[model samples]
Target: MALHWKLVIDTSDAPTLADFWAAALGYEVEDQSTLIDRLLAAGQLDDSVVTEHRGRRTFRGFAAIRHPDDPFDRDTGVGQGRRVLFQDVPEPKTVKNRLHIDVHAGAEGLAALVERLESLGATRIREFDKGPAGHWWVMRDPEGNEFCAAQ
Candidate 1:
């Protein structure tokens, strides 16, 4: 039997978190229209509850993505297996993450990517290199979540 996983995260703003992760991971945002558009057209979904998303009017709510080849709901655009769901919360993040992502980037391109991320509102928390065999960068997302850009 195969297993699927959804990495759920808590955030003050789900859409902003979604955008940051999408750019950080080089993945496109999943279109959530599969279930929404049909419901709207059928008059089953309320207009006030849904709004525009990615150029189309969608339910004002969640977003997600998957590896290009992964299975997804054709109508809703929800990809099975690998996924990260960012849900809204009232409280702000005030502590360290128990788990984080490590981005493996080539040496030549790492610096440029780091700069780009900084420009996009990420902060370089620190740099780490031991002797000559190890190197990587610790960066904080706009919301202060930690991730590594491995070199």
Candidate 2:
């Protein structure tokens, strides 16, 4: 059987990064308000670990995004398919990422896709073109994490 997985990224601000990725990937920000509330009520969680975002209570220093069509636990709002989690960290990013996400332009075409990403706070680093191979751009997200935008 295939193993289940989700990408976990470290960020200075989890909610903001998660929002950026959700928009970039057309994914839904997972809403864990129900689980948070339940935990709080049962004394399993502390109020200090919660914060409000988008008018809902969520775990502080943690956020996640998931593919819209993926199955998820309704009670917990945890995705069972393609998902990415962002967690807060004290140290800032000091080097290039060992692994990075590659975003395809799909029906929008490469130029339009890059433009859209820029509007959403992505910065173009450089472009690559290999004669019969492919074309792509190296870009950084709002938090300075590198990723690829490809046709």
Candidate 3:
């Protein structure tokens, strides 16, 4: 059986990172505030552990984005597939990423996509002109997470 999985990224600001990744990947930001609200009402969760994010009551230090077409729990809004979870971390990024995401934008569309990503707070790190493998741009997200965009 195939095990289910989701990528988890550490960030200083979970919600902001979620927003950035959601737009970058054309995914939808998961809204789990309803569950949090219910837990708060039942006294199972404290208000101190929740905060308003995008005008919704979400658990502090956690946010996620999922592919829009993926199945998600109706009540909790947790995606069943193709999800990325962002969690708050106290320390800033101090070294290069050991793993990174690669976006395939096709040869004709890469330039435009890279420009769009830059406008959304991605930084152009460098470019690799691989002959047969094609070209791709190395970029860092707002929080310094490295990812590649391929043409």
Computed on alpha carbons, the lDDT of every model, listed in order, comes to 0.76, 0.97, 0.92
Off by over 4 Å in 2: none
Candidate 3 residue 106 C-alpha distance from true site, Å: 4.6
lDDT assessment of candidate 2:
0.97
Model 1: lDDT equals: 0.76
Q: For candidate 1, report its TM-score.
A: 0.84
lDDT string, candidate 1, 22-94, tens digits: 8877766677776887888899988887767557654455656566666788877887857888776678888
The sequence of per-residue lDDT tens digits that candidate 2 reaches over residues 25-124 is: 9999999999999999999999999999989999999999999999999999999999999999999999999999999999889999999999999999
Residue pairs in collision within model 3: none
Residue 145, model 2, lDDT? 100
Lowest-scoring 10 consecutive residues by lDDT in candidate 3? 102-111
lDDT of 2 at 68: 100
User: Rank order by lDDT, top first?
Assistant: 2, 3, 1
Error of 1 at 2 (Å): 3.2
Clashes of each: 2, 0, 0
